[model samples]
Target: MTAQLEATQVASTQLDKNTIRRRIAWRVAQEMNDGDIVNLGIGLPTLVANEVDKDVELLLQAENGLLGIDSLALEQQIDLDLVNAGGQHIIAIEGACYFNSADSFAIIRGGHVDATVLGALQVDKYGNLANWIIPGKMVPGMGGAMDLVVGAKRVIVAMEHTVKGKPKLLQKCTLPLTATGQVDLIITEIGVFNITQQGMELTELAPEFSIEEVQMATEADLIISPHLITMPTPH
Candidate 1:
């Protein structure tokens, strides 16, 4: 809450898209467990695949009806028929299986998913999420977000700290709700937060920024953790 923490408050202009996205991805990947069944939502969430630890293996599922996703295909490896929920070319790892939406939703609804990473437009202190649409703008229609949040054992949100200097993490979500009290963790370029019964708690922050910087970017009141850690991003 005070500006004397150590570093200056984060300015929206100080962040770049690629750096912020990758840093968010790196932090989120560290949360996945070995052999976990995971779903990475479209857009920013998909970048998480590039950051998973090499020693930890995970099963990737695309809501578009594919499982065992290996990685985003290289230019030469592209298969016209294969893509993730985001519609990007991907390679299916060996033993990967494909099915229709019914089977895919069944996997999600059946509680087979271990964790799901998604991007949010707004997330509040109560763990409420709203990312599907923005008021009057034509938005990407809600796909499997509602099901994943309700079905996955854990739900993590990957996103930027702010949008053009506007706070996205707020006292309450201004957009349509995706689900209520379902988010477990949220990773942004500036800090990592845990949605709790008390409110949002700052667990970790980028080493370059101070707690003051994070507080300025976020609209909701942040509960400073007793054991906060500094998270350094890979260059």
Candidate 2:
């Protein structure tokens, strides 16, 4: 391929990946109810904040002590002290509050958070989450994920369906568990899965992908929902 064509392909590939991430974020944002106190975990979960409707009255909590995360701040507009748990600079909305880590943990551990969106390294058929570490690889220690998953009334995992073309949805998680049997729902680039008493149920699929594709990529046995539908593209 010509250099120009190669460059265009690279850009297109990056855009596709970003579109998938935004789609997952948008779907996760829709799960939030009005007046819900939601926590956005680091990485992909943080993208949900950008997709959230401004009219939705969500109290966005950051474990590092901010309580009302808005949109991403521009370089010149960023406040060094106003960063989220992931250390990303953010804009705070009106009625935002700040407290120490103790108070933040208090809110999370007390079950005051209505819902939490987290990114998972792997999710099993049983809905177990493994996000904190990869065995033998250097990783930042598990910070507040354990507390959020356990304390939030609802837990939604937003992640890619696969990592480097390998399935992330498996019969059992090979990595260390961040929280066991805690995930309620999972939103990925290709589909949505609901963790039910029976097992992981595929409820929605991206328009571009086929059920067979999803099945082939998922290592776990996926129960197809009778009402399975194609997920709408984000506006």
TM-score of each: 0.94, 0.92
Segments of candidate 1 deviating more than 4 angstroms: 1-9
Query: What tens digits encode model 2's per-residue C-alpha lDDT throughout 1-235?
Result: 1432333333335448878788889999889889999999998899888888878888899999989889777899899888999999999998899999999999999999999999999999898999999989998799999999999999999987776656788899999999899999999877899999999999998776667767777888899999999887687
Listing every candidate in turn, what is its Cα RMSD in Å to the true structure after a full C-alpha superposition? 2.8, 5.1
User: Positional deviation of 178 in candidate 2, in angstroms?
Assistant: 0.9
Off by over 4 Å in 2: 1-15
lDDT of 1 by residue, 1-235 (tens): 2442222234444667778788889889989889899999998888888788878899999998988888788999999999998889988888999999899999999999999999999999999999899889997688999999999999999988776557888899988999999999989888899998999999998876778778877888999999998876876
| Residue 89 in model 1: lDDT | 92
List lDDT for all candidates, in order. Answer: 0.87, 0.87
Residue 220 error for model 2, in Å?
0.7
Instruction: List clashing residue pairs in candidate 1.
Output: none
Model 2's TM-score against the true structure: 0.92
